[model samples]
Target chain A: MKKESQFTPFVEKTHFWGSIFSVLAIIVLVSVPVSIMFYLNVRPEISDVLKGFWGVALIFWPTALIEICFYTPMMGAGATYLSFVSGNIANLKLPCALNAKNIVKPKKGTDEEEVVNTIAVATSAIVCTVVIAAGVLLLSPILPKITAEGSVFGPAFNQVIPALFGALLGGYLVQYWKLSILPIAAATLIVILAPTIGTGALIPICVILSIVGALLMYNNGLLTGGVKPENPLKGLVKKDK
Target chain B: MDFKESKFMYLIAFIVIAFVIGQSLFFLIRAYNHGKKIGLSAKKMKDAITASALFTIAPAVSILATVVVLASSLGTVLPWIRLTVVGNLQYEVTAAQNAMEAFAGSGKAVAFGQDITDPTVFSAVAWVMTLGVILSLVLCPLLLKKIQKKVGKVKLDSGSDNKFGDIITAATFIGLISAFVGTSLAGKASTIEENGVKQATGMGAGVMSLAVLLTSIILVVILQTLCKKFKWDKFEPFVMPISMFAGMGMAMLVYAVLPESISMLEWRPAV
Candidate 1:
């Protein structure tokens, strides 16, 4: 029998602890409001709680489920646990992991990629916590300028997501220009034509469409490797032969 | 006791923040040790840490802005803890509003900072915000392993290995970025009545956002060229933040130069 590698056991142990600590964290977090309500001798009506929850959950729960399916494969097991717990997966954790992976050039579906992702995510979580804590501590002095209506800082702050993603996306656009056009065009058309479709719904739809488009292009020999539609899924299992 | 920023709340914030920091440190050390054991270079690991830390600062500042925004309604300590933990500003704000509306009943708009004086209402907002996002935490622990296994099985059974795997990851990323880009560009052009005079408001902000995005993309292209020309591999990590800050600065200039009638940044009534 071939001896098991040291890395597999380490990953297994990390997952075990990651799950336990995540559960503990959830318990403590839930208790905060519960304890507050208990101390104040006030409980919201179940009807009110359910109504409020349904309003947000109607959009959020589906997005959360889809996000897990989409992002878990990219981020790996440890980073997924940490990223979900820390939040800001799209705007923060995902970008951080992608940047790290881009720099390291770790082969896909490997243990090394997992390590790089974990380190990047953990560092991001630490930096985010520290920065937010510092901001809270210094809130009294900086609050006025940062939050002033019509101020330059306010506009700049609002544009951070667009600005950050625009640059980050440019890199990917360059690498996969042929594969990128369809999704970009399709998403733009959808948003322009149907203003009511929120991002929560738009993302999953666009992803499915993009994957189908790429597969079709690859099959038709439009992609770099000439028409070879043996099976796109088959490519995932075979190494770089 | 009044619903003011309190010492007790700060105590809670500190405890939660400490827990998050501890958790991150634990994972960071483990990953670092694993990297070393696998014969990954010390330099590469250090570079990843440094690069991620640098990349985090700009977004972290934006998150600080979120904390400020939420603080106006949710108080200091709670927003501090919420934004630091599993809550984003958009969801938290909407959840708080929903809870307030639920408490106030139909057809009544309860302004958050002003009318959230009732402790019961405050607790309701807390519960909604907390419970609204709790599903992710529950689902992650219980289902993440299964999800990973499924993905692995897909890869194993597919046989093509890395090509299909790469396509899935790339497609997902492209889809996500495309959604954001499209949303940012899609702004309504309807007129809003102000002082019995109709004026356009949304179009200007949308244009300004596009301008900012364009500026960032140009900056990224320039940085990419320079990094390649100068062989400055060390500077690659700073490209995102540098581009972002440049775009933000351009936005400030745009905001300053635009006329009041067509201003991109609307002046809100001071809280």
Candidate 2:
């Protein structure tokens, strides 16, 4: 392989420009509907809810677009790659039956080699979704409905599904992982203390605590439970670059 | 069947049907690949199929629970707004000549139920928008594409094997059956409205069912796409967050662009 072969398409100009188109699509989408609201003299009460929903979403979509488009895809690819590595490492000491066959084993670069393959596909998917969902989310408030109701469904309830998912995750962890108590404690404490920091800060606080706690545990060489705080975001860092 | 008419009921049926049918295809593929190692048997295969089908409902139940909580919360916040305008003197709502009529008021008792803040049917319609778009945009295309590719490639093989034929046929069939179950439940949900107060008969179950049905379809789509790419060979836990946000956006788009005449069907105060 050439020395330059180590470079990835993500760092290349074409990728950057493509992502730029996605981000542009996002910005246009978020602002368009709110602008129409201004154009049409919608009622204050109704508009307030619609506008409030739009406003929060408008801010979130761009921020999330940047994360999903540029961040999560890379992270997901690398995380899965690392998972394969760790899986091998965790299985190394044992008398694995597979090794007895003396088959052609993968080189060390199997993980890194696969990184580009995974990231390219993941990033493309992320970009496609960002455009479509963003256009829908941001522009829906302005557009008319197709069905009998005259418009689309309420989305605020959609928010509940996420919280429910969190609760479900919490349930699964509490049942399966005895070590889950630590993170749960950490989460609860962070949640309670979160308000002191300010509103909309729980996620960041949880992420930081989890990351630090995991690192501390790892440095201490006591990493078996798979119950770290930064488990998800740790999956995000595409440092293979 | 008045104000609370099920808007996206048909879509729900389509989705449940798709799930049941889709299962058969997935089974055939699984049996072909892992049946030898996992111990192939018709009985075991049937058991596996049943298990997967049942397990899918766990997430569905979780979604339903979410719907209940949300519906109740919304119900609490938005109820029937009642206002009795007894005697109202002339007052111009809009400026005709800067300012038009100015008169006296006598007795006007404005009695508002919980729904005073939001007296429109935006909430109901918003859900329809959410379900409709995902069904139309996400599930339809993904299902068609996956079937075309999976089946199309098979037909090109030297000849279709027993395993190959079974996998394709079973997967599609399972998906179809699941859609039927979902749609059946939703169809049974009743709607009633009186004196400007419109609500579903079993609001919690009905709304939650829609969300669950939509989520399952989304999971199917995500699974189809991600599996082909990553080959993870399992459903994802984080699919909800992705689907929720995506579906939410779809709802918003559907609502905003809806025509005024249709949008006007939303519930309002009869003040």
Model number with the top TM-score: 1
Write down the RMSD of candidate 2 (Cα, Å). Answer: 20.4
Worst ten in a row by lDDT for model 2 chain A: A93-102
| Residue A185 miss distance in model 1 (angstroms) | 1.3
| Model 2 per-residue lDDT at A109 | 22
Q: What tens-digit string does per-residue lDDT give for candidate 2 at A176-229?
A: 233233444554444333312211233333334443554455434345344433
Model 2 regions more than 4 Å off: A1-52, A55-182, A195-208, A223-241, B6-56, B66-271
Query: Which residues of candidate 1, in runs, are more than 4 Å off?
Result: A1-7, A225-229, A234-241, B106-109, B158-164, B187-205, B258-271
lDDT of 1 by residue, A1-241 (tens): 9875333676678779789878978987897788778766898678877878898788688778888887888799889888987888888898889878877777776678889999999999999899888877876567658746466587677677678778777667656778778887888789777765756678778888888888777767676478565666445546444
Candidate 2 residue-wise lDDT, B1-271, digit = tens: 3221123322322332233223223323432333334334434333333322322222222222222222222221111000000000000011100110110021211111112122132332222212111211122222222332343333334132333232222222222222222221222322333223644422222333334435544553554457448864333323433443444444354336655444223222112
Candidate 2 TM-score versus the reference: 0.30
Worst 10 residues of 2 chain B by lDDT: B80-89
Candidate 2, residue B55: how far the Cα is off, in Å: 4.8
